[model samples]
Target: MIVAVTYRYTEDVALRDEVRPAHRDFLRGLADAGSLLLSGPFGPAAPAGALLLFRADDQAQVQAWVDADPFGTRGVVASATVTEWDPVLGTLLPAL
Candidate 1:
């Protein structure tokens, strides 16, 4: 299954920046392990939030990742939400 994780950062961009390196490394690690599919922050004068795509067997796996994230541990992320995804129209038809 694919899980979508939406992370909302607090107003302190510096906090987010400070933790971003570790966060990116963590995501890169997940990518290497074939879990993370894509991730990027919302930008251009928008609220601080990011959308991350992951391939996980269940929400618990995704939650585990979230728990390990530096952004979460360091409190850079103010809130987060995870939802299972079903991609029905993409080139990766098998994903559905």
Candidate 2:
């Protein structure tokens, strides 16, 4: 199943920037392993959050993976949530 991982970043912009590279690397590893499908920041016009898509066995697995984030370990994430997502039509799939 697909899991949607949402992250609410801390208000400390410097801390967020400092941990971004490590966080990106962690996500990259998941993508390389076929777990991460899509991910990005919410944009300046929106709230300070990130959305990540993951292909995983279940919510528990998704939670476990997300809990391993460097940012989370370092307390850069103010809050996080994992939800099971079932896509019907459009998605972030690679172009044919």
Candidate 3:
């Protein structure tokens, strides 16, 4: 199934800044491993939060993946949510 992992960052400017590189590396690794379908941040002009899409068997697998994030380990994520998404429309893949 497809899962959407959404996370909100804690209000820690220093920690957030410190983890930015590691976070990017982690996402890049996931992309290389073919687990990360899409990822990006959310905010007005910059990024305040993030959304990651992954293909996994169940919620546990998704949780494990999210838990491995450097940002998650550093408490950069104030909260995280996982939801099942049906890709009824998208440009990255063939029409469903």
Candidate 4:
């Protein structure tokens, strides 16, 4: 299953900057494990948030990952929404 997580950052820019390296490292570990498909922060023109796509066995597993994120652990994330995603046609992801 594919799980999509959206993270809205807090207003604390300094904290977010401080925690970003650790956050990226954590996500890199997930990607190395073949769970994180893709992830990126929203463009500067957009909102202050990020989108993460994960290939997981279930949403619960994705939730666990989200719970362990540095952003969440360090209080850099203001809010997060996790949802199951289905990709019918996408070159980046394998065909369903």
Count of backbone clashes, every candidate in sequence: 0, 0, 0, 0
Q: Write the per-residue lDDT of candidate 3 for residues 1-96, one digit (tens) a residue.
A: 888999988889899999999999998998898778889888767557889998788888889989999999989999999998888766865621
lDDT of each: 0.90, 0.88, 0.87, 0.93
* Rank order (by TM-score, best first): 4, 2, 1, 3
lDDT of 2 by residue, 2-48 (tens): 88989998898998899999999999999999989889999998889
- Candidate 1 regions exceeding 4 Å error are 92-96
Model 2 is weakest, by summed lDDT over 10 consecutive residues, at: 87-96
- The order of the candidates by lDDT, greatest first, is 4, 1, 2, 3
Better of 1 and 2 by TM-score: 2
Q: Estimated TM-score per prediction?
A: 0.91, 0.91, 0.87, 0.94
Task: Report the C-alpha lDDT of model 4 over 1-96, residue by residue, as the tens digit.
Answer: 999999999889999999999999999999999999889999998879999999999999999999999999999999999999988776775532
- Single out the weakest 10-residue window by summed lDDT for candidate 3: 87-96
Looking at model 1, the pairs that clash are none
> Evaluated with lDDT, which candidate comes out highest?
4
Model 3 earns a TM-score of: 0.87
Model 2 global lDDT (CA atoms, 0 to 1):
0.88
Question: Which is superior by lDDT, 2 or 4?
Answer: 4
